[model samples]
Target: MDLFGCMNVKGRSGTKSQSVKFFILGEEFNDDAKKVEVYKKSIDLIKHGSPRGVITPIFVTYCSRFSRMIVCYPYFDESLSDWLKRYKGGSSNLPYEIRIMIRNLLAAIEHQDINRLEDISPIVCVKSKRDNTMEVKVILLPVQSEQSSKAKWRTSFSSLLRKNMHQTWLEDKDFEAFLLMLESNEYTLENLMGHPVLQDGDSNGRLILDCFRETLTPAQHKELEEKLNVQKYDGGDWRLRLQGKTPLENMSKRSTAYPGHDFLWFARKTVAHFNENDAKFKNATVNRVPAANVIKDLYPGFISDLYKLSLEPQYLNRALG
Candidate 1:
């Protein structure tokens, strides 16, 4: 149940610029006062805080307030960086392995009230040291706060969808917020990138978008409400308890349907996975990657004018039509 000095620290760590983090050993937390609270919360999150079968300690703590201040978790496996490195660039293929882990982690993030989960990128999850035998255990760290919440939300959420790359079941409006953020970018798709897309970008325009994205149809929102009712706080699999109301599930069917024409816009990314590797490395792919338009599957006529605005950098002024 306890992993003593089980520390394997790596990555861009410990700096004023470094986002908030907790060490696996006594070093897990720096703030003495909040450490206890964080550890307790973490324990609650683990469902099985004892860390008996985890590959890494879910966390380290003592009943003593001092012990509670410290926490520990396994090293992050298949990090966003790892994903990019393995794929050679931006070609994120959603294999089953990544899918299960990612689904679990996003679910974890949905449950996390921590504001810091926003800044991090290329989302990842790790098995627990205590019981590699149990269901997957993931640790999502803090994201940078200084960046505009909108930008951070855009990057993180898009990165999740891009990595998962699910087809056929988007439910449209369900994930519109993840793609075209509501608080900031809804009025103009240009501002659709961060959490709460912002409350007041263009009041009238936002009012319309808010009506669409947040105001899910009664049936759609009803399922979420129903599942949330059976929440069992015993640290069991959150997916099991939430009755399928996952972070991804919040997406709803958009009342505003796009034009009927379907087109695959992307041509492959700079960073794709190695699922089709051969000879010595039989896990990499060599296929045509394609564009991920701001909106896809639009009516042919409307598709030409799909997105006049670009996100700058790699997509700068490139004709989307």
Candidate 2:
């Protein structure tokens, strides 16, 4: 029989653990002997499989009363869904959080492909730990009787990305391109890992803000300091400018003290040069401008440019030799 549910368990060491939540394969078998056989095969596959980013079951037992297999895994701090919910309004670590998720998820999928564990749905079982550093855990569930094909797994993975990720961290173009490649089914796992979007570097908006600050004229800097009361442009200020909003207007004291109309005009003009040339700037007059919300959306080509810059001989020699 194909069935799945969640249950809390107590470990031998006295720590509480969670049972693996199974993904139903829509296959049903009435025979007890056949169910036992399927359970054994699933256990063996997990026992021998060495899949990075996949959690190995700590214990497995056949319950005669329930006529079901109980698979318990080590305690996970939280599910991926819960973790993402905490940051729905957005956070500074969102880029790092997303990058870690993508890396582990891809690794788990690669492992599944290698071990022929296509029936194991890692995407459904994603978890995370937040002790010292953020980490993603892909809990591998028990194998199903009628295993899902590799194509099915790919389609499922792609659908999950499209559903959950498009509105979040990644830029639209980057995410769409990656999704296209994923759905293509031609690229190897290694090739996908090497893709520019997957490659890690820096996503710090402060760096880009500093670059913008450098382009500011001496008079413009003075105006920003005196009128807007902005000494240095931080990430928050940069974000407001990107959204075609003024930082001074958002602050209670500044909003009251400064002339709202005049300050907003000055602020817009101050950032006009950078916004027009370097960043994606929306018109403040527009009722709803679909602008880049996260730092990942700003300068989508910057990360790739940084990668190319690193490959240059001057940078390579300085860093390596």
Candidate 3:
């Protein structure tokens, strides 16, 4: 099918810092040539040069020798930022269409992860030319290549994770479980946090964690193998594709199984920590609005920590005993 898009050029664009210009073949395009090449290679590497379980946007280079480049996608009625601003609660309770876009985007990411390809672009939402539909499209843009070392990339990854408050849905226990899953990949719980506990002052340790985080497990590693295969990429609903595919439920079970524990003991500790912090703020002489604001700010981190603790059997066993 011939994919088409408009040239009206409406709405806000990404910042200059987040964008780059590229020279493809002999023509200039406003993107990175390397990213375009990588994306082209990814397309060729997939099952049929067109992956299923996701709708990848078509990139049209307007020349035999890649002289010009334009990403052909349907016109999106709203940017994710604008949509989130209008919708109040962000991705937590996104409208159906937007949710589909985000899900598809993540599915694309999963495809890249599954293929073990690096330097792929995150998906963007756009209005489709095919029946004016809103869809997620992956645009190949150059990522900053200055982070040449594993440590540098790991630091960047953790910092990004910490800033994305929406990831609170993972919960602290789930976060830790996910970490454990990644352990076979050589990542530790600390690799995902900006300022991991205890080892805060050790740059060398952070570097080591970063290097570990990028290490991929052998394909023969069964446990890690299963989690990485969570979605089958059969071109179905992204949510359905992820349902029960991984052993996420197993993690939840392990998290709640501390000796003589009914409820997850570590989960309770996280709640206590939040309450304690809130109490401290309330008792302070600060204005009620600011105090409340502070609690709100701190609450998500506590939740994240609580989720992380779920993966720590040693800590749970020690504390519950």
In candidate 3, where is summed lDDT lowest over 10 consecutive residues?
Answer: 195-204
If candidate 2 were superposed on the true structure by all CA atoms, what would the RMSD be? 12.1
**Candidate-wise lDDT, in order:** 0.32, 0.46, 0.34
Which lDDT value does model 3 have at 220?
A: 18
Q: Report the C-alpha lDDT of model 1 over 81-159, residue by residue, as the tens digit.
A: 4453554322112233433443444344333432333323324444445875223333432211243354555465565
* Candidate 2, 1-321: lDDT as tens digits: 243555676568887565544333323432566566656756765667746556665655655555555555655556666565565545222355565556666776654642332323343323344446656656655544355566666676777666665364444555555666666667666545544566442222222333223345545444334433331223343334445444322432333333423333333333333345433333432222222223334434333333333334554344333
TM-scores, all candidates, are 0.32, 0.51, 0.34
- Superposed model 1: Cα runs more than 4 Å off: 1-32, 47-57, 62-70, 74-78, 89-106, 125-178, 181-321
Task: Give lDDT for model 1.
Answer: 0.32
Q: 2 or 3, which is superior by lDDT?
A: 2
**Residue lDDT tens for model 3, 44-81:** 44433334324333343444343444444333343344
For each of the candidates, give the backbone clash count: 55, 0, 12
Error of 2 at 187 (Å): 2.2
